[model samples]
Target: MAGPKSGAYAIAAVPLLFIGTLLGFVIVGDEDSCVSTVAAGVSVTIDPGSVPQTEIAGYGHEQLVNAAHVIQAGKDEGLTVRDQTIGVMTAMGESSLRNIDYGDWETGGVINPDGSRTTSIGLFQQQDGWGTREERLDPYVTSTKFFQEMIQKVPDRDSLEPTIVAHRTQVNADPYHYERYWAPAVQIVEGLTGAQTGLGGASPAVCGGSLVPGEISAAGWALPNTGPVTSPYGPRIHPIYGTLRFHAGIDLAAGCDAPIWSIQDGVVVGRGFDRGGNGYIKIDHGAGIASRYLHMYDSGMFVNVGDKVTAGQQIGLEGSSGESTGCHLHFEVHINGDTVDPDLFMRQVGVPLG
Candidate 1:
């Protein structure tokens, strides 16, 4: 995710339409792209020191302060709360919400497409195509540059998933790389501002944060999906294999694109497609406990390899990807590396399967 780092809008006289519907916003840009903006006098401020906690989303005071700069940058661009959250999430994934004097070449060096070492630096990990080295090092400047790009690149971002919008803006290799930071970014934004935002309103059901939400048990467990269990975990004729085999997990039919929450906090140990091209996520929860979810489309996955996810945090959206015949989640619980009945295990942990 690298490019021009100029902070100014440079917005060429794009036409504007006054949307007098209850929310009253001025829509800027063309049909394919819409930038939601309030009246000129409306403004936002970010007080990093006002955050009650010294740490947020695993980041310390300095890092949260950097995120505040990002929020202010997005606000200055008149971006919605969701778009601002995307800005912060992108920075979190790229630079851990901190600015650095050097870039890709100095850290984990990588050759660019033209065979030159990557020049990615700053909060957005921008390349030389961005502004001067000094500009990229400035938080509000770099973040403003980022929001300007997002407004031009993302189409109808107000209706799209925040992670997808970030992916489109940054042009990252993995479309979902910014996903894990989403929940934390929402928390940081709301906590710092002390106001409920439109972050996840009308957005995809990602039970991470936003006006929507998630729930976890005191035992550190959560239901993957609150839908009905369509299939139990046990030995039976394989639905696709056509042979008598053990079904390693229980199947829950939660509608397509429904959020699939992680049942326990853990590191994502693995993710890959099955024979039918559907995807799966395996998390190791320690104490010999682990869980797996299957049948989501590749893009539906929210977290990635090595992402430390929390209980009830969204990990993926349900889909009929692999050998699946329809939309649902094939959820499995494991103990000591052996498959166990998820219904029984979750029930034991006070997170009974639906």
Candidate 2:
């Protein structure tokens, strides 16, 4: 009987001891253990700081640092995120964010390949006339120079398409070359700053908080049509006219009468027929961002010139009303009156248009 009782008491004491050990560990632990289990059961969230240095995927640390410099330089000059994005996009298109000492006809500050240095160097690959070799190589100076030139040359740069603005400032041979880099540039800026680019509208976290007028929503955007793109936005031979022409917008082949939706919230600015007789509707999405829907059936417009529309709201129906061989929607995105590739513009705003 005594042995049995003693055994039972030991068993009970063992559990108590184990519980005490756990409690002790919880209340007081060595540095390592404490750190490991300090908040094991509690949720912990860390908000990013201003100018957060979060690593951008597929980018080296050096590239990220240089990108940060561009953003900071833009801010220093009181430029908006749009301007900073333009500078970064230009850098990406020119040098992939590297400050090379060589150019088209030169290498390592010396002429190579018999006139290979085209006098373009630095993060922006600025020409020799931009400044001295040293200044061009300096990321800050080059970015500042680029921004100042953009301001001086393109006074309405902020309202213009990023690639167009970059083209005007750089005088590059290809106007749309930098267009493809807009999405990456936006990602880099967001990754570094932990803030939305305000391309479509204010980010959800900062919505309704001192938003700049004409700022696109950072929350998200909508795809006007998910159908296969019949004709992409760019230079191409017109199917109907049989002439080389610039396709200002993308063509989505959604059978006739397919609903065409507004990409973002905005007031309808214009609704009329183009010279080609294609019925169209234009929405001013603020922030100098406007979307146009063309080739709607001549049945009339769903929203009027003064009507305010919301994202995903049906604005019209797709049709081959103007200059069309078949039924489709010709969607155009205009920034400050310059037509940009609708597909690229959609991708930049986080809504990829295929």
Candidate 3:
């Protein structure tokens, strides 16, 4: 938990019978932001004066309050923290988290081919087709409308990257338009909720409710990334080399920049480019056991050689930097400095990967 949020707002355990005074220590995460459930048809009213932080993610009180409203709408819709983060990310990309009455047309943008200006407004800058002007201007209503549309447009949202899902929902010109705002939106949502929400994408190997996606297993080891195994360890045809080569590691379908965690507490023994300039990091975890992550770009590397890292700590972002065709995580488990089947070893350690 974030521990005793003493900045501006006070969070309470309003959902339970007995409310605790301790801050940031709760079962359902930050209660100050979630007022009531949407199934109850209770309107989430955001009073800008009550917003605690003067700024978060470079946004002032007004913008942050609008974010809270967006989050509140997500909550009302029974969405997860990941979904909430995406909602906020989309809003930030569209309007800088501000509920502006003006839209692209007013600013000489998004001109229609028919010589007419498209009308978009509100925090999401949604077109007039979304709702009436007054409804579009209302943060909660606009956000809810956005969420409803997203649910219909992207039914497989959980399996996709946040920006891709947002793009599909918004139908914006560029798919990666909202990419830069994703990290900031994740920071804002996690800061407000005290919950670990951003897992890069909703990878399937969720062990349990108690464990975050990557931070599973009790034996000082966790899954590096929850993405499913796209390629298994064995002799296989190399995609780039176009020759049958002994595939050394398992490839996960993690997309670009997905946070990859360390599977066990260890010291970084080596980190560099392979013969093909594929970025890799090898960690020695003692007992002749080691692990390595490959294909991360130089910028994606978050640790240096000789640095001690703990299990579940993020080591790098997923990338396709070498002789690879696409973005993926090449993970290898080692025994006595020799490569082993990561899927088998991970399963033996309580965290299984496909």
Candidate 4:
């Protein structure tokens, strides 16, 4: 298995959409292009601290605060702190990084302003018609796959063109296209979550204060009663989308109501449901890293938002909820919003996968 920096991985980029009559096109050969010149020419400036009043309208401040813990995991995984900025930027750009329920207006076979039918789908607006449906919607799977592909392109932090190419080949094919917007995107991520980039000259921290939600600490590894690890982090069959997305966390086959254990000591910052995340918990450990427990039994959640917890504590029971096939824990590790292998982080902390 290659580390996160290896970009040898190739997965489908989110298929493009016309959005409105604003779409323009160019024909390379026999194929009629449906890309917009405005999209091609326009530079996207992301103010990391500025939340779209129209977008993310319903989420409470606490909900956004809790989600930041998961974002910080990207940093812990050894990615540049900018990876967190880019990840959140990608989220904002892709699905506004929002876990949405409604489908594209053209979801079931509708045409775009360019007369092309919108077949691609989801929060990042990934398309199943272009890539496998299973790969598109799984967040960890898609995110890891995206990072793997992007890392191949980024020779260094300064050259993110390859990474952008891996994710949005059509819109980002020109190297300089996204350059103007990259800093803004980074600013948006850092500003929103209160995470420090440690990068010089970044805008002031907006949401200053970490909101790590559950208990996480360095200690001995006691596998949850959830059973043998059927799917360790990295590419796996996504139960919900029916495609291949990177599994950021481990999944163990277990019965519903099984006791879920905390790997370390921390605080509970988020717990709730709707789509995508289903039932989840986030634990924050100082040092800009955090752990996540997702898709568990809602009825069995022991802690709530803002509760502090210790190592090996019970935060929630395992179950099959929102976007899951069976009862299992979708475990994840994030440092600065970049997802890294939790297993690697675990071993570093003296806990073996065994």
Candidate 5:
């Protein structure tokens, strides 16, 4: 088995200068104006409201979340956290967000006379056909060896491209497969914490719900409607702004005044008019996560900021609210202070909205 410490260096070596630089950029304002500071070899400015609202969860979303947990777990096990992105990208390409226990048909490996042992297993899905059963389940053992092979093979570390290239030198699989998923993985990382601490001992955020019993998504665990999702989450034209901005939430497109429900039970966080002149609702699902219901025509809100709600309970009427261009239900799922695509979690429960 590879010494556990070997992998830690791989992950730790890559300084998160990219994230630090990005944050500095976000903090700095235009030089022509005021509110600027020069410090520590860089300039710093602040934009009070530059943080964008985000939503649009999908397979990519889950992969990012899982990757963070995996990274942290690796660190706890005395494994390197650096250069581990290669394994992450590979996992994202192979299984999306799920910690799959089985591999695909083309994903070759182990074999059993009954045709069972060959199944790809666990988060990285090492095949029993290639290794012992114990080895496949131990993420640290599998991931460490994988990284050892990658670093020894690849010469370039300055860019993600060559790093990934080096990692997959033997697969003969498309080198670009892991590269394409990088951006989406980063997006999930940003939305979750605005930082990359990985699982490091940070408890998962507990979101809306009364059960408080089991681990559920920081995003509410239920859908706002049993009705099919009318529009998928992603890039869409702002009906009012007319500028292209990301659609942070999925639109249910339910009939106006129809009963709308909460995904996971939580407390009413806010209910009132948004700057756009449409009535809106915000629910605090706990653990710094919240849900929003927008475009209600009526002034009466079903819950208050502190009022607890049950999952799937009627929370409001679906109507155009807050600068809305039409009479459609606007919904949002937020983690910490950032919005993530609700569709990602929606798909987990097999909700058929879209």
Candidate 6:
């Protein structure tokens, strides 16, 4: 929730590999050639007026032009660069940045799959009710409509996940559908605007040197609790139940009343006691990634379900409030829906668990 002026946010030197081949771009001052570094320590330059077609590579000239309109609309509306990126990302998911006149239909725009012609159109594929056909087809008009609805639906627009904000506007069947385009959207936005949008929140001044415990991995994750992994994630005998069962989370031995920080920026989805009577908090970090912190002290949660939390922000105090035998923090990570090994997931992201 910290603003750029707070000095809490900084551009981490995280590689743009998530954006794939899009990283091989240079700033071109003229139409003839390109240059490597735009400024000292800054590899990309901001040319908001034009799209980096060479950088984006695969996108056609029309797609790039439509994307530029969306970005320009966000700027005209006085929205943040993050909001503009979300707009571009939504277009990517809805129509691949192309204004199509047909949807849910076979080739040649006939033979409906469900015996119907979907009126979804434009760069966002907005349905017929969204606007008139002429207006829907206009990039600026459609982008304005999308941004206006997004501003109305999302309270803290800048802090919410980009896909969540887009979903609120598009009302897509899959809320996470726009997630895959996020990294590319960000890269495009930065490549064209030169604004380094941090991970929706503040970054640690130094990876491991911040007052917050644990080092921030290159993938932008931090340990939820600063303690050794006492209970590894997997099948194990339940300490309290005295039966063998699948342990869904890894327990960090943090003793009583230890601070629990969020591993990444996300919206708090669930909080309170589970059926087993364990106090817990769940956060949706987008891209189908979610994290949960369990067995917190009865002081309840520091954040509500709808609140947005940044990485390393304390959300609760660790305790033995669940079916736990000792005070510790039980943390879990989920991709899509299936729970995965927390240690392996963390290590894969460049943060090793002790």
Query: Which predicted model would earn the best TM-score?
Result: 3
Give the Å shift of residue 255 in candidate 5: 0.6
How far residue 105's Cα lies from its native spot in candidate 4, in Å, is 23
The lDDT per prediction is 0.70, 0.64, 0.69, 0.47, 0.49, 0.66
| Candidate structures ordered by TM-score, highest first | 3, 6, 1, 2, 4, 5
TM-score versus the correct structure, for each prediction:
0.47, 0.46, 0.53, 0.38, 0.36, 0.48
Flag regions of model 3 displaced more than 4 Å: 1-49, 113-115, 193-354
lDDT per residue as tens, model 5, 1-354: 000011000112122234445443222222232122111122222122342343424544444445555444433333322334345555556566456666644455434445653456555555554366676555545555445555566543322242244234325344444555554544443344344322121111111111122223455466675445766568988777889888888887757656667777677767544434556678887877788877764322344455667777666656664566555777777889898778785676555353
> Candidate 3, TM-score vs. the true structure?
0.53
Q: Global CA lDDT of candidate 3, please?
A: 0.69
Candidate 6 colliding pairs:
none
- Tens digits of per-residue lDDT, candidate 4, 1-354, equal 000111000112212342222211211111122111111111122222343343132344433432243244343344544554455445444444554433344434444445654444433444443245665555444554444544555433322231253244322223333333444554444345333232212111111221123334445444433456767889977866889988888776666756676667677666554334366778776577788887664334556666666676666667776677777777888888788987787778866553
Which portions of model 4 miss their true places by more than 4 Å? Answer: 1-226
Better of 3 and 6 by TM-score: 3
* Order of models, best lDDT first: 1, 3, 6, 2, 5, 4
Model 5: residues >4 Å from true position, as ranges? 1-221, 349-354
User: In model 6, where is the ten-residue run with the lowest total lDDT?
Assistant: 1-10
Q: For residues 1-354, could you state the per-residue lDDT of candidate 3 as single tens digits?
A: 000000001122234332222222223332433321121111222334456866777888788888888988886886666677789999998899888888777775565545567777888888767889999899999999989988888875644556677877887777767778887886676555444332322121111212223574667678898788999998999998889999889999767878788898899887655555577888999999999998876535656777787888777778886677888999999899788898988888888885
As a whole number from 0 to 100, the lDDT of residue 139 in candidate 3 is 93
lDDT by residue (tens digit), candidate 1, 1-354: 332222001123223443223222333233232223322223244755554557765788888888888888877787766677788888988888878776667775656656787778888998777788988889889899889989898755543456667777877666667667877887776555543332422122222322123588887788898779998999888788789988899999979878888898899987755433557889999999999999876446666677787888877778776577788999989999999889998888887888
Q: Model 6: per-residue lDDT, tens digit, 283-306? A: 999999999998764332456667
- TM-score between candidate 1 and the true structure: 0.47
Those runs of model 1 whose alpha carbons end farther than 4 Å from true positions after fitting are 1-44, 48-53, 198-354
